[model samples]
Target: MDSSTTRTKMTVEEIVDALRDKIVVQELAPGVKLREIAVASEFGISRPRVREAFSILEERGLIERTHNQGAVVARQTAGQIEALFDVREVLEALAVRLATQNAPKGTWDVFRERFGPRAIKAIETNDMDYYVEAVNEFRRKTFQEANNEILSQSLDRLYDRTRVLIQRLVLMPGRAAAALEEHRQVIEAMIEGDAVRAEQLKRANIVSARRWFQDFKKFLL
Candidate 1:
């Protein structure tokens, strides 16, 4: 992303990576066509390679083929987001519950500290990098120690295309602080060895986030 990969000769995988980054960053907005020939010219690659890259991106649900348009950035729908969060809420809450009960002692101490008052201050100043990093790290450690194969696979696949959306959701007005506080409560419950309370708090957190998405659907959709 620091370098322009669009003007360079790229392999199909590289082209896919470049385009995916573009879509995630909203440089290629939803429903905007990505003509194969145009992309080939942009990347200084063959049309066939561009087509191959399109296929890969389509498989990842980043883009879709239309009647006349070769490929366009996929549009996100409210219904789709609801369904995703529905399943995610259950799976993630269960994961936290299991991890809290199973992880070795001191496993969540770092996250417990990370989600403290300092994170709220960062959110107040509109700095999300620190908060997002902490959330990602907390999730990584939770899933790592969750020790549930079914939950791990399900949750990983569910999260694949949600990175961008999650970032956007957290940036909503008053959302960053609310989410950090919600996460802090979950972490506190885990630290206290209260798996049931942690699970409930996590589920409530997901529900709160889903409501935020619904409230902002006009802007997002």
Candidate 2:
């Protein structure tokens, strides 16, 4: 009798992703109950597998199982968002820096342009889909090429927590253009194999995002 969707066979990972996407985009807003039975039915999976997906989502801070409410979507406070940004700077800076040295040649040529003309058009048109995909692509590819399992694992969780915030960040006036340029510089550093420079640029970008989040708090919150 609870919420239901189309049923399909899916792996545990797929179930997690489907739920995560809904949560990130606010379809599964904070405090909404995620019934294990309902989700299991929707995904055509066993209850234990749904539990496994819930465990992963909880680890990513996207959900919490309350005393009586069971598992529900989680909401972040302003303080929590700031904390995520802090950890993100360190992890992502190291990620980009290491990617510079570890990524094969030409690893960044596509990204450099993605953050260029494609990003520009996306910003101009206010295409959130393209922006989101571009950002995810860069993060995914950068970590994959970074060749550091520990760093990648650390970042994977942090990225999930702050992913929506970054999406929200672009909505601030002029923030999208600023972010596009910042990403371009970071990509340039990676392309040149300037690890230190890449790291610094990435940190600067996070710093700017944090500052803007504070400055334009009303818009973002």
Candidate 3:
């Protein structure tokens, strides 16, 4: 065993990222308490550092802070989830519409090349993590190509919460294939310059996924 050690101090952002990963993977499920001292001990850091991380996570909608209870993982009720999807459905529909109309030449071509195959490959290999990453990447590219900074920023707030649910959704039996196919159809509409069709397809996909959550909330939420 080595006696000497050299370790750099972890930044608040690093701590936040680590905690966020745990939330995303459901290792720290919704409503789990996050005690500063416990976390500090686990990370070999001070309590103040963990507090800073908790503040950032709270701002990002991944954690909620209560006066008496301190911090707990953000828990979405069915109503909260439904309301989020309502906003997301509208915003994403607009994003798809705008992306279809405003994306620069070859943008969709590049996106399809980069993400479409990877999503299918992820499904074929049953790599749910990779598929989730691919799906998230596709969303980032779509928002970027939409060229609406305000819209993108607004939806991003929802993403920190929505993505957690999406991970669960994608892992359900038969969902990966359905999601991949839905995404491919949306991309095809975008590439073909059918803004209406693209928007419709994107909204439908989101709404359908929302319904799945509604039906399965007992296990999912």
Candidate 4:
């Protein structure tokens, strides 16, 4: 395809999506260089568009630009990951608390019923993609129901950064099952209208999961 035609066909959003998927799936490993020219050529787009997409990814903490190195998939330090988890615990705790108090009647019932069984099936069948999608959907729906736009936006950004790490961690022995149970407890507390318990449980759950992920730091960074 001609350069101009390809450039016209591919929007900045499309470029961003492609790159984001690569990063999420670990096709572009942490700290791996992302060459602008190579990505532009691969996507059949101009360098400017690729740069724009990289800017978006950078803002989302999916990639970073280094002096003389262009863009690379972001590599979180141990300290950074710990700090990220700390912030996430607080934010997610607040989200669950608000969701419990403000949820429409029966709003969380659908998720409560579906999530555990889906997670068990994923584990039994060894279906990583479906498992990740199911968990992501549950979290997304919870944040949506919370009706706190600022908190949702913050969590969304953090989720983007931690997505790959979470996927890797969930595949570890016992982590998936543990995560399922944690989700169940959080949902149950929410159902019982115990906002304080729900928030504390949510925070503890995230912190525990973060520890599990930290155990795989050798594989990650």
The local distance difference test score of each candidate is 0.84, 0.86, 0.83, 0.85
Which scores higher on lDDT, 2 or 4? Answer: 2
By lDDT, the candidates rank as 2, 4, 1, 3
Residue clash pairs of candidate 4: none
* TM-score, every prediction: 0.79, 0.87, 0.79, 0.86
Query: For model 3, which pairs clash?
Result: none
Candidate with the larger lDDT of 3 and 4: 4
lDDT string for model 4 (103-221, tens) is: 87777777677676776887878887776777788788779878999999899888777777788788888888888888889888888888899999999999898888678788766
Instruction: Report the lDDT tens digits of candidate 3 across residue range 1-221.
Output: 12121114577878888898898777899889989888977887778778888988898788999898899998878888899999999999999999889986667776576556776787888888777776788899888888999999788878867877888787777778887888888988888999999999999999888877877778886
lDDT of 4 at 106: 73
Per-candidate RMSD vs. true structure? 4.1, 3.6, 3.8, 2.4
Off by over 4 Å in 1: 1-18, 38-52, 147-157
Model 4: CA > 4 A from native: 1-3, 121-130
* Per-residue lDDT of candidate 1, residues 91-195 (tens digit): 999999999999888888888778887888889888899899899889988898899888897786567556678988888898898899899999999988899
Give me candidate 4's TM-score against the actual structure. Answer: 0.86
Backbone N/Cα/C clashes per model: 0, 0, 0, 0
Give the winner by TM-score: 2
lDDT of 2 by residue, 96-157 (tens): 98888888889899987788777788889999688778888999998998899998988977
Candidates 2 and 4 compared by TM-score, better number = 2
